[model samples]
Target: LLWSSGDESRGAEQALFQTVAPFQTQVSEIERSRRMRGKRQNLA
Candidate 1:
């Protein structure tokens, strides 16, 4: 029973990570672009 419950929780964690991973990548991409824009403004 304990092992089964542990497996279930682990599965849930993986599912949550899968759902969140894309959003995290998108957020990082946006931040990178924003930083690049800021650098361009500073240069100008």
Candidate 2:
């Protein structure tokens, strides 16, 4: 019973991770672009 419960929790964790991973990548991409724009403005 304990092992089954552990597996259930792990499955839930994996599902959460899969969902959040894309959002994290998108946020990082946005931040990268923002930094590049800032640098360009500074240069100008």
Candidate 3:
């Protein structure tokens, strides 16, 4: 029973990670693009 409970928690944790991973990637990408644009403006 303890082993099964541990597995269930692990599965839930993995599901949460998969759900958030894409949003996290998108947020980072947006931040990176904004930084690049700022650099370009400075150059101009």
Clashes of each: 0, 0, 0
TM-score of each: 0.96, 0.96, 0.98
Summarize candidate 3's per-residue lDDT along 1-44 as a digit string, tens digits: 99999999999999999999999999999999999999999999
Over 1-44, each residue of candidate 1 has an lDDT whose tens digit, in order, gives 99999999999999999999999999999999999999999999
The C-alpha stretches of model 3 lying farther than 4 A from their native spots are none
Best by TM-score: 3
RMSD of 2: 0.4
The TM-score, computed over Cα atoms with residue i paired to residue i, of candidate 3 is 0.98
